[model samples]
Target: MSATRPGSVTFVAVLVYINGVLNIIGGVVILFTRDQMVRASNAGAIAGITTAAILSIVLGIVILIVARGLLSGSRLARGLVTVVMILNAVSGVILLFNFQFFSGILEILWAVVVMYLLFTQRANAFFASRA
Candidate 1:
C-alpha cells in the first residue's frame, strides 16, 4: 500500500477489527448473563433483549469480515463499512437521549473518524486501484 493509503485505510481497518472484537465479547457476555436481565423484565422483554444480543454478535462478525476485505482494498468493504458507521451513529444518537451521553458521544466520534478515513482521497484511490 502507498504511504498515504496506509495511514487512513489501515487505521480504519484496525479500528473496525478492534470494534468488532469488543462487540462480540460484549454480546457474548450479555447472552450469558441474560437470565439476570430476564428476571427483572417481562417475558416479551426477554425475547427482545436476547434478539438484540444475537444481532450484536451477528453484526460483529460481519464487521470482522468487512475488515478483512478492507485490508484487500475492496470497494465493497468500504460501502459496507459506511453503512455500518451510519447505523452506529444513529444508534449513538438514541443512546444520547437515554442519558448515556459519554458512551454515546464516544461511539459517534469513533464512527465519524472511521467514516472520514474511509472516504479520504487516499483510501478512495487505494480501493480504486485494487479494483
Candidate 2:
C-alpha cells in the first residue's frame, strides 16, 4: 500500500470518529427514548430521529471502511468521500426546512465538515499520490 500523508490520514480518521460517535448517540437515543420517540414519530420527530440513527450507523460503517481504504492508498475512497459529502449536503438542505423541529444546525455542520475534508488540497493530494 502506498503511504498517505499524515494530515490526510488524520482528517479522515477524525471524520470516522465523528461518524462513530454520532451513530452511538443515535442508537442510544432510539433505544432509550422509545416511548417519547413513538409519541413524536407521527409528527416526523420520532421518524426523523429513527431515520437519523439508522443513517448514522450506516454512515459510520462507511466512514470506517473508507478510512481503511484511504490509509491503504485506495483511490476509490476519495471518490466515495466526495459522493458522501454531496449526499450529506443535499440532506442538510432538506433538513433545514424542518429546522424548527430537528437538529438542523448539526446537520449543516456535518455537511460542511465532510465537504471541507473531501475537497481540500490534502485530500486531493492524497488521492493523487495513491494514483
Candidate 3:
C-alpha cells in the first residue's frame, strides 16, 4: 500500500481524536443525565437524546475507521469521509433548524471542519499519492 502524506495523516488523526472526545463526552452526558432527562418525561425529548447519544457513538467509530484508512493511504477513506461529511452537514443543518442549542452549534462546527479537511488541496494530494 502507498504511504499517506504526513500532513494528511496528522490532520485526520486530529479530527479522529476530536470526534472521539466529543463522542465520549456526549455519551457520558447521556448516560449520567438520565435522571435529569427523565424528569421532563416527554417522549420526544427522551427519543431525541437517545438518538443523539447513539449517533455520537456511531460517528466516533466511523471517524476512527476513517483515520485508519487515511493513515494507510486507502482511497476508500476519501469516499467514506466525503459521505460522512455530507451526512454531518445535513444533520447539522437540521439540528440548527430544530433549535437544538449547544448540540446544533457543535454539529455545525464538526461539519465545517470535516468538510474543510476533506476538500482541501492537501487532502487531495494525499489521496493522489495513494493512486
Candidate 4:
C-alpha cells in the first residue's frame, strides 16, 4: 500500500466490499424466498423473481471486483465508484417524489458526504501519489 493512501479511500473500499456482500445476499434471498412471495405460483412472477435475483447477484459480483480495485488504488475503480454514487444520489431524488422523504434525504446526504470524503485535499494527494 502507498504510504500516502487516504483513510477515506480505505473506508470507501470497505464500504464497497460490504455493499457487494449485501447485494449478493439479497439476490440469493430473492431466489430462495421467491416461492413465498404473493402470486409466486404464476409463471410470470417466478420469471420476474429469477431475473431480479440473477441481476442482483451479477451486480454484487461486479461491485466486489470494484472494491478490490479500489483497495489497489486503481483510478478506474475510483471512476466506477464515482459513477455508482452519482446514480445512487439520483435515485434518492426519485425516491423523494415517491413519498419516501426521509430515505430520499438520507441517500442524497450519504452521497454528498461520500464524494466529499473521496475528493478531499488529502485524498487527492494520496491518489495522485499513487499515480
What TM-score does prediction 1 earn? 0.73
Better of 1 and 2 by lDDT: 1
- Whole-model Cα lDDT of every candidate shown, in order: 0.86, 0.68, 0.73, 0.87
Regions of model 3 farther than 4 Å from truth: 1-4, 40-44, 86-131
Give the runs in model 4 whose Cα sits over 4 Å from its true position: 1-3, 38-40, 97-99
Score every model by TM-score: 0.73, 0.56, 0.58, 0.87
lDDT for 3 in candidate 1 is 33
Error of 2 at 63 (Å): 3.7
Model 3: number of clashes?
0
lDDT of 4 by residue, 5-106 (tens): 788988998999999999999999999999888575698989998999999999999999999988787778888888878998999999999999999999
lDDT of 3 by residue, 22-103 (tens): 7867876785675587766587877777887877777777777777777766778767776767787778788889888678
Best by TM-score: 4
lDDT of 4: 0.87
lDDT of 2 by residue, 22-120 (tens): 776777767567557467437677667767777766766777777777666577876776677677767777777866325666666776776676657
Error of 1 at 124 (Å): 2.0
Q: Which candidate leads the pack in lDDT?
A: 4
